[model samples]
Target: MKDVNFIFIREKIASSYLYFISFLGLITITISLLEIKIPSHSTILILLLIFMGIAEYFPVRFWRGTSSLTFPIIYAMSWQFGIHITIIAIVLVTLIIHLHRRSPIQRMLFNSTQHALSLILAEWFSNKCMHLLINNIDMSVLYENLISLLLFCVFFCFFNNRFYDLLMILLPQPYSIYQWYKKTVTVFLCETFGFSYAALMHVLISKYSVEVNEITVLFFFFPLVAISVISSFSVRIRMEKERLYELFLITTEISRGLTGGNLKHIKQALKGFFGIQAYGIWTKDDGNWNLLLKDGKVHFDISDHSEKFEGISKNLVFNDWKTGTAPGDEIFDSVIRSLVYFPLIVNDELVGMFVAGKSRTAGFFPEDVQSLATFSNQLANVVKTRILISEQEKRMILEERNRIAREIHDGIAQTLAGVIYQLESAQKKYRDKPIDMQQIVEKSIKDLRGSLGEVRYSIYALKPYPTQQLGLKQAIASKIKSLKQEYELDITYHERGHARALSFSKERAIFDTLQESLQNIVKHAQADKTDVLLSYQSEHVLLRVKDNGVGFSLFESMVKTKNEPHYGILHMNEQAEQLGATLQIDSSVGKGTEITLLIPDSQTRGA
Candidate 1:
């Protein structure tokens, strides 16, 4: 069971005791007004009521399973037949009135009927036990002993289901069932001993009054008290065991969820573990607090007191009580009695606040405070890790941009500059010596054509290819058309499987890699035809570029080259790794090269 929930139950029991005491006072007043002669034995009824109230309200160290004291007390009072009848009637009336207030008349009547029947059975059993013990037997005093047993049965009938429900809600299946069994046995044993003690007391006070046998009283008292104490202790041990087990289970769930990087699951585990009314983590965003995760429904509008957080600096640690003028007063005016706030710090900056609220219990204790702090620390670590990963991604993007810029400047820009210089020199020579006009014109046209080719290449590199402009299917078709036109190579491109809009980074990488592979096939492979196939599977996006031409051993080339400057293969591999993909190359002498690039889907990326 959550510690907070257990505390709430404890508080409810205490409040119930006060209510019971008030009921007893009302009974006393009613009897006095009726001019009824209160029997000395009737005092047992008031004493029983008080004891039951105390047991319910106070946190007793002993396990006294609500039955131990309740049965004996009720049994002792049952001897006063008139008082028992009056109290029973009052109980029935109270139940009827309570139910009627909350439910429809028909439902209230039905519920009242059930409660009335239970009470009737209890009264009937009490009367029968009394009659049985008072029969003309050698042990007439046994009548008193029978009272405890009868009361135990009556109380068990009334509360067994309730106890079972409580355990089921608070504990896991196996432990809850075990606790229910233990409680049942404890109740039976306690009632037996209590009844025996009552019988012995009757024998001593009435039958052996003249003899005054101290030894007999001692013998009975020792065993009776021992039985009650032992039963109570056992019940307590079981409750504690169940409590600890629940705590361990909650902790395990929280740890597992956090390790798996599920912030939502972690938040839910924390809320369940602590039994808080509502909990949330608020992150700072551009001088405003934004709710990141929350558990439970909150009715109050937090925006009403936005000014409070507005002045609070980012990265500042602020507990619920600390930021307010009064220790416990805050902007929110809901059922939350206490609020714990932890500032999530990453790299010495306050990133967010882990806020948890209390509802049916007192503020967090020292242990709870420590736990909250630990949870916040773990939460901060997760946030920090995410931030670092994001930073690394940004850095990689910057580096890629710089490299692309350099490649454009070296390959295309420098070539265009050389062509421009040659054309300008030829134009000057044609103007100076009009005698060689044909040679100068041819030279100028050649240089101009070279510049135009460089410009076209640069533009083609900038334009979105068919694959990127449309999709991989169209891109492959476009590539095949270009190959047929440029090299007079009959290329057949085929596509199979479903297609999807891949991430921009992955799409760019795959397109560039395909471009390089096709270029290599045209420039190096001596083949008549080329075939490219693109396939999409459930796990990955696959692209295969092949050429029926002279192929070289991939493994041999890698081993032979130290600084081969084979940017095509190297760049392709780098892009694949960045997209969390895999690239495989297959080739052999006198055979075509089959280059395959597999970009995994999001689900397969993890694997």
Candidate 2:
């Protein structure tokens, strides 16, 4: 509130200062006009030009350029002396030459020359027009001179230092139009009241037909002082309000843009929001801060603080710190102001820190600090959600690997071991007899081929061909063939309804589940015949693997105590779940085990 009042006061004072300069210029012009002796037209023109040149100086430096000379020259000649054409041409040519000059001294010298030349043109034109417009009236010379001086004074006040400074200070700040209007109103009121009071005092002093008294002069001072105070307060209030609003906008924009998925977006958002000198986000890896994002193209030196952040698991907590304040400790103090290191926490663990520095402005205020904390909290949530999803995906992958490993060990590995045992037995029998050499070779070749077949089957199981290459029906048929050949079971395959290619995931899951069910039938079901059927219904693709074997009760076996293993049914259900399918199993004492898998027909039809 005090800051706002201060800015208001400043603006009020600035506006009054401009009015005072105008009043002084008016007084100078009035005195010149009321002179006892009539000055030569040339002298009057020269004096006006000098005042115009001085007026041009303020705007020139205020604009930080030499181009403002045009405003005063054009106003003085066209309005006061009525010398538009010749004076304008000379001023244009001189301004062009002046701009082309490299040195400031040369530019100023050219400017002075142009002012003098313009004065001469104005005097010549005025002198010629005076004779034609007014024959016996020397009043023409007096009027022209007085008007020229008045115009010069007015132009001088318009380009005065106080006026230009007030404008420059307000223009680039936010809410410029409102601030300008407020200042203008304050100045208008002050000038109006001052003039009115001065007029009233003049009237009161002359009531008795006497000269203006000291009391009347003192009365005039009150309005000038009041104008200065009011203008200052108005200017200060407007500026403070504008600054606070700008800060609020910056915070809101930064918050909305700094979502955690894109590191570049976060950095860009922060840079625009804070207008800081330098800032970055660093990910904490193995106790070290790794730079992930930075504003602009600054190369930050992390060598010194590498060890400090290396083992710091949580956010590097700093007390009484701010966004850009250099670190309080000796090592980090040189390059930074206050450092705000906020941890990017996810799932109750810290992932990274939003480390920022402030150099261009003072450290963040309380509002900015609170805003930063809120932004960090939001960032942490995003980072945490992403991390959790990633971990879940990784766990799923590991589980899949384990399932594959179990399948290889139980099916292909066991089959190869049996082949090896058979070959060894055949080898011992052949070593004892020479007459049955051909039979031994045939038996050994058979055993080796069986091992090779099992190896091939394992490879195929690990990486099946695309469903498009061979339809899902053909792929399932192939797997059944391999199982029949390898296991030598009385396996029967059947298909019903229209068969079509299924989605990759659906096909893989159905094939894997079928394999597990058949393996269970071969290893556990003691029945002589096994039947596998594939069929499509209105909304689902169904696969049933049934075997007339020594079936155990699924419920009783699944509920067995700690020492028992029941991975086959669990694996089959998991595969179905993965493909968004359903699995059902039925088994009873003295009855065959029947397993059915139902996959959505839409999925199989490439929905």
List model 2 lDDT by residue over 1-607, tens digit each: 4743665575566446545544543343344335424223544345445433333332211012222323333443344345433243334444555455433432334343434343443455555555564675555443544444444433333333244445346321233556445654544443344334334433443455544333433343334434444554554456446545655554454445434565555554555454344555555544555555666423546435433443444434342332233332222322233455566766667666666555312245444565566666776665555556667989998987898688768866776677677667776876767668567557757766766766776676667464556767777777778877888888888888766656677777777777788878777787789888888676888989998888898776666633322246776677788777889888887888888999886634454
Residues 1-607 of candidate 1 have per-residue lDDT tens digits of: 3744664575466445434444544454354347445555444444444443333232223221245433333344444434434345434443545454443333233333333334445666666666675674445444455454556455535543343344234321123456567766655655565555555555555765633233442353445445546656766667557545655655555444334356655665555554455666665544566655666534345433433443333322222222254222243334354566676777767666666765422345445566557667776666556556667989997987787678668755776677667667767776767667666556657766766666676577667766558775566567668878998987877777766667777667777877888888878888788777777788887888888899988877676554543356777887888888889999999977998899887534422
- For every model shown, what is its TM-score relative to the native structure? 0.46, 0.36
User: Candidate 2, after superposition: displacement of residue 429 in Å?
Assistant: 1.8
Candidate 1's C-alpha runs over 4 A off are 1-140, 147-149, 152-261, 267-271, 285-287, 300-339, 342-350, 363-370, 384-518, 522-547, 550-607
lDDT of 1 at 564: 44
- Kindly report which residue stretches of model 2 are placed more than 4 angstroms away from their true locations once superposed: 1-261, 285-288, 300-307, 310-338, 345-349, 386-403, 430-607
Candidate number with greatest lDDT: 1
**Model 1 alpha-carbon miss at residue 167, Å:** 20
